[model samples]
Target: MGLNGSIPPDIGNLSFLVSLDLSWNRLHGGLPKDICIHNKLPRVKELQLSFNDLEGEIPLGLGECQQLEILDLLYNNFGGHVPREIGNITRLTKLDLHWNNLSGTIPKEIGHLSNLEFMDLGSNKLRIHPKRSREQSYTKTQGNLIQSQRENCVLFVFTF
Candidate 1:
């Protein structure tokens, strides 16, 4: 489908919808601010909007999608710090935000996601917080580490 224009805010009205994949499309625009608010999409487990032109900071309300397991927004134009609220999605297993314009310290809260099994946050301006560097480090058994060229910035992929 040759989708063009923004995602309809009314999509949140689908109370029983589970997953939504509008990836690989021309959808260009930030996600509706309230679309992911608690109970708006109580059952959504996957939300893939990759390969689009969507821009802006990742919604702070996205954490309300408590049931989300896979959130893929790779290859977009999204910028700003990766929201700390994302760590609230305890059920999330795969989060691919690769190749975006995101910058600032990678939230330390991310280390608390015990259920995260795969995450690719590379190719962005993100850096590990100096004080949290030790706290963010995982053993070899937890995941494979990929050191970035940026000094003091280490990005890893937790794949099991």
Candidate 2:
């Protein structure tokens, strides 16, 4: 179905929604402030809203989606910095916010997402501060090793 204008605030009513794909549409206006109100979509795993005409800041309440695993909002007209509360979603594994007009420092809280494996923050005007000199160097060397091992394990599982 073709959805134009603003996304309805009642969208959160889809309690059983596992994935919501509204990409490449003409949907305009700001996202509802309480898009994820009532803790709806407790089982939602993926939400794709890329390449739309939507504007304004991303709803911070999205952090309440505990079961959210993938959130793609690329190529939109979204502005403002990404909400730091996004780190509260511990189950997030993949987050893509590339090619948008978003600006400002990427929240340090993002580092707390231990389960985040695929993060594409490219092409945005976000400033990412490196960890302290010593910590940065240590994580670079040690973290790379750990990340490589994890990637290998993921690849192995996928291949099998």
Candidate 3:
């Protein structure tokens, strides 16, 4: 069902929550700061809140969710840099933050997500400004794949 209101902070009390999909809804307001507070979502595997009217930075506490595998926050109004804390969730595989108002360089910590399979940071205010040594390392293997095709892609880089 599609809801059209803010999520209750008490909802985070569901310590047993395994998977939550709140996509394509009319929900507004920022997510609860305690949604994953204190490692609350120990069993959570997937959390999809895409295509909604939600705004604000992703809750910093989400990094405590050690079991998270898929996190989809696409097409929202979220702003600010991707949280470095998220890189602490070693179990993450798919992370989607596309089509938001985020800015700043992609965090180097994201490169540490060894399990990440898919990630999309396109269509936002984000930029890519890599240091020379890092660019050279990637260019050697990836062949400078990022062309100056789009204005927002001025410093984009790809790593396999």
Candidate 4:
């Protein structure tokens, strides 16, 4: 559907939704914090909402989707720290938050995600606070502190 306009909050009503891919659309506005209201979306493994105009922080309630594996929110306008609560999703393998306006240090809790292999937080205006790298294993490793920063943006990556 070549739909226009923002996503309806009632989208949370899709209790059985598994993979909600709404990429490359004209969808604006932020995601519903209670998108998984009524304990729904627990079964969701992949949520693809990239290349749109999605602004605002990644919802804190997204942590409720414990089974989320691939969260693609690239090339958008999402801001704020990558929510620390997201670290609770241990099953995530590919967490792509590239090309956005996200700021603040990526949560240290991300190192706890042992299963994470591919993560891209590149091309953002985020800060690379020393604290976020201090406890992370990737930074401790030989030399895995990859910084593919954009024009004046310092995008730090800690992959393990």
Candidate 5:
């Protein structure tokens, strides 16, 4: 489908909607602020808006969707800090926000997501706290892997 334009707010009325994948489209505009209000998307498990032209901050209300397992917004024009409220989604397993225009520090709260298995925030201006032990380990692991192919690899690691 060649869906274009902002996501309509009425779509949130689907009380039982589980997943919303509008990726690989020509969709533009930011997500409606109220779309993720409490109980609006009660059972939503996956929200994929990748490869679109969607711009604006990733809504803070999205954290209200406690059941979200995968949130992929990569390859978009979304800018602003990664919302710390997203850490509230303890069930999130995969989060990919790479290739976006987002800038800011990686929220420390993200490290609390023990269930996160796949996270890619590359191609953005985000940085991690080098003092955090957990982040250091993660950086070292990533750095070592990349260093194997290139002798001089400068790593700017972030925790999530």
Candidate 6:
């Protein structure tokens, strides 16, 4: 089907949805604001929406998917800040947001994702300009934490 305009508000109704494949469509506009309201995909393992016309900031509610392991939003028109809440998904292993129009700093909270194995935040306008020395220190600390986490893992692929 040729899904156009904004993503359907009722998409959250698929509570049992384990994997959602909405890639390569003409979907546009910001992701539904209520995309995760009253809906929780606890068993969802993968969410692929790559190569689409999707635009706007990723919904913060996506962080609610506690079981999400793979999140692919590559090759889209999405822009705006990458939500700090994404760091809440501790189970995330593969997160691909590359090839988008997203901007703003990568969230420091991302360091909290202890289980992230493969991350691709490249090809986006992610500017990390720490205004203060303390901020820079904190960001560096987070970077070290990520490095430590990767060191402990046998396999990890990260691209910024």
Worst 10 residues of 1 by lDDT: 141-150
Q: What TM-score, to 2 decimals, does candidate 5 have?
A: 0.83
Candidate 2 C-alpha error for residue 81, in Å: 0.6
lDDT of 1 by residue, 24-66 (tens): 8898889888878868988999999999999988998888899
Comparing 3 and 6 by TM-score, which wins? 3
Better of 1 and 3 by lDDT: 1
**Per-candidate count of clashing residue pairs (backbone under 3 Å):** 0, 0, 0, 0, 0, 0
Error in Å for residue 92 of model 3: 0.8
Candidate 5 residue lDDT tens string, 16-73: 9999999999999888887779688889999999999999999898888889999999
Q: Give a tens-digit lDDT track for model 3, residues 94-154.
A: 7888888888866666655666666677777765555523422112224534333222322
Counting only residues 3 or more apart in sequence or on different chains, how many pairs clash (N, Cα, C under 3 Å) in candidate 1? 0
Displacement of residue 114 (Cα, Å) in model 1 is 0.7
Question: All candidates' TM-scores?
Answer: 0.84, 0.79, 0.82, 0.82, 0.83, 0.78
Please name the candidate that would achieve the greatest TM-score relative to the true structure. 1
In candidate 1, the residue pairs with backbone N, CA or C atoms under 3 Å apart (3 or more residues apart, or in different chains) clash, namely: none
lDDT of 6 by residue, 36-87 (tens): 6455665778888988888888989988888888899999988998899888
Local distance difference test values of all predictions, in order: 0.79, 0.71, 0.74, 0.74, 0.77, 0.72
In candidate 4, position 124 carries an lDDT of: 72
User: 2 or 3: which has the higher lDDT?
Assistant: 3
Residue 126 in candidate 1 has what lDDT?
70
Clashing pairs in 2: none
Candidate 2's residue-wise lDDT over 1-160, tens digit each?
Answer: 5767778888888888999899888888877878675687778889898888888999898888889988888888889998988888888887888787788866766656667777766676766445533321112233222121234112000100
Kindly report which residue pairs in candidate 3 clash with one another. Answer: none
- TM-score between candidate 4 and the true structure: 0.82
Candidate 3 lDDT at 37 equals: 78
